[model samples]
Target: MFANIPTYWCAKCDDITQFSLKVKEPPQFTFAIRKAMDDASGPVIPYETNYCDFCCKNCGQPVRVKYDEHEFAMSSYRYLPKAVYLYEFAL
Candidate 1:
C-alpha cells in the first residue's frame, strides 16, 4: 500500500555492505526528515519515521519491513504509496 511514499537514497548506510531500511524510508512520513538530512546536526536516526523493514542486521539477510505506529506518534499514519502523494514545494 505504501509503494507511492517517496524514498530517498540513504548515503550513510549505502557505504556499508547492507542497506538500512529504517534509514532509507525516512522522508516518507515527515518533512522533518528532509530537513534533518539538510540539517548541519549531522546524521540522526530517523525514529520519527513511521514505517520500517523488519530486518535482522545480525545475519545480513533481507527481512520484511513492518509498519509500526506506536514508536512514532507524529507519523502514526499509513496509506498507499500513490494516495499520499506530495508535490515539490520550494521552501
Candidate 2:
C-alpha cells in the first residue's frame, strides 16, 4: 500500500489541515497517471474518485476532502467555495 498525508494551510481559520491518500498501487503507477494528466497525447485511464466531509478536530468546522487513486486534497470548511490548487501534486 502507498499512502501520503500532507498538510494544507487554511487562510480562513489560520491553521493547518491534514489530508490523506491511500492506494494499493505503487508510486510508479501513480506517476504514470499524473503524466497522462499532463500530456494530452497520453492515453486516458478510467479511475474513481471519492470525497468525504468531516469536522475539524480542532476548530469544529466542517472540512471537505477529495481523493483519487493517486492523491488527496483538502477543501474549505462546509459549503464555502474556495480554490484548492491540487494540480501541483502532479509535479
Candidate 3:
C-alpha cells in the first residue's frame, strides 16, 4: 500500500482535506492475466494496480483513488458526483 495520504480540494468543505484511503487489492485473475501478458511480451505489464476508496470526512462525498504497486504512486483520483452517489445509495 502507498504510504502517503493525498489531499484533494473538497467543493462542499471549501477547503483542501486529506482523504483517508482504503486500499483494495486486485483480484487473483488480474495477476494471472498480467503474468500471461508479461510472458508473451517481456515485462510489458510492470505494475499491478489497486483501488482505494475515500470520502471527504467533512462532507461525506465519495472518491475513488487508484494506486500502482510497482511504482508506489497514486495514479489518479476521481471525485464521485453527488448525484451519482445519491442514486447508488438510493438503490
* TM-scores of all predicted structures: 0.20, 0.35, 0.40
Ranking by TM-score: 3, 2, 1
Candidate 1 structure quality by residue, lDDT tens digits, 9-33: 3333442223333364432334543
Ordered by lDDT, highest first, the candidates read: 3, 2, 1
Error of model 1, residue 55, in angstroms: 4.1
- For each candidate, the alpha-carbon lDDT, in order, equals 0.33, 0.39, 0.42
Residue-wise lDDT of candidate 3 within 1-91, one digit each (tens)?
Answer: 3336666667666866565444332232245443433343332123454434445567655544444445334765433221111101223
| lDDT for 66 (candidate 1) | 32
Candidate 3 off by > 4 Å: 1-3, 20-47, 71-91
TM-score of 3: 0.40
Query: Higher TM-score: candidate 1 or 2?
Result: 2
